[model samples]
Target: MDTPKIELTKDGSNTLVHPKYNAHYHSTAGAIIESDFVYIKSGLDFFIESTQTNSVSVLEIGFGSGLNAINTYRYAMEHEVFVEYIGVEKYPISLEVVQQLNFLNFFSIEDKEKVFIEMHQSIENKNLNFSEFFNFKKSFQDFSTINSLNQYDVIYFDAFAPNDQPELWTENLFSKMYASLKPNGVLVTYCAQGHARRAMQAAGFSVKRIPGPPSKRHITRAVKI
Candidate 1:
């Protein structure tokens, strides 16, 4: 594995890195929080709450630093919600890089670092269900090739911007994702591009734009209708 060159962005708080995928991952608004702003504070948190499913499955497009997965697991533990987290990443970051992430600084307690460490250890090739709240499967593969009947209740399309990875944002890709979603399953993403919305619509999803976090103007949500 190549060593990652970590750089502090101009804000002096966000830790930006050129990951193995030639993409960047950083906290929003100079906050050490990772998935909080993108995955939690956004409508995803509310979507999960509204669904009120006793056991739910989630599919993540880009695992990146595993921030979203970790945050979701922590939230499930706190709420006693049974969650199955499946994250897909073509280029996964090394465990060392994930450990260096400062996600807990954005939270109330620094002791959460230990929890993150345990989360990393918990991730394995096969689904490892534990704590009665978290079950995870981390895969290194392209999402387009994945074929499965509609199963997941929620989908987190956290891939890089369409400008960078146009293929991943295409109508064809969205069609595949649509096939992977159960009826009424919702998909959330940080992209609000017109073409992206059209592609999702072309895949039979009902799409809508929503307010994003600070620095980001808009986000998107789609439902498998």
Candidate 2:
């Protein structure tokens, strides 16, 4: 993939549109505008908020530009909750490009820059524990072929849209994810394609259709029942 074109939005948010991925951060209209839409509105908030467990483990299919991770970190901080955020991404972005994404300003204190750098650099495929509020493992591989089961409390299935990558949305892939989640764990996505919903159902997820943000009409959330 080509280097993404880095640009700033009117709200001073960063956006990177590469030939393969158009990732946007910190804007109201971009790809990753709000956690409410990308995570919360998709019912991730409900799972995270309602869980009584001391430590919550999340498995993200595509870490992408780290927008979901960043937002989840902020949420954990605000709620004083413990989280273990694991993600898988086949094509990891360069460290420099990751730095250019500017996640520090999302927090209130200027010292957040140090924490941001630490968190971003700590992501590795091997298991790593970072403090009480955060920990992550980056599986530098495809999600469909992942072989773990009954590990995660929440799964953020935020792959590129089915139109962009159909292979990631198939029934077989959802079946893999279905086995990956702990019983009653939730999986959320911004996609609501009919086939995708059917695939989730076929994989044994109790799916729900929810309202989406802006241009999108619907999003999907599934519980491993």
Q: Give all TM-scores, in the order shown.
A: 0.85, 0.86
Against the true structure, candidate 1 reaches a TM-score of 0.85
lDDT of 1 at 194: 97
User: Whole-model Cα lDDT per candidate?
Assistant: 0.73, 0.73
Model 2 root-mean-square deviation:
2.6
Best by TM-score: 2
Candidate 2 lDDT: 0.73
In the range 167-218, model 2's lDDT, one tens digit per residue, is 9999999999999889889998888899999999999999998887776677
User: Model 1: which ten-residue window has the lowest total lDDT?
Assistant: 26-35
Model 2 worst lDDT run, 10 consecutive residues: 23-32
Off by over 4 Å in 2: 7-12, 21-28, 109-111
**Model 1 clashes, total count:** 0
Candidate 1 lDDT tens digits, 24-121: 66543543343566566553576676776677788998876666776787777777878888888776666787667666555553336765665565
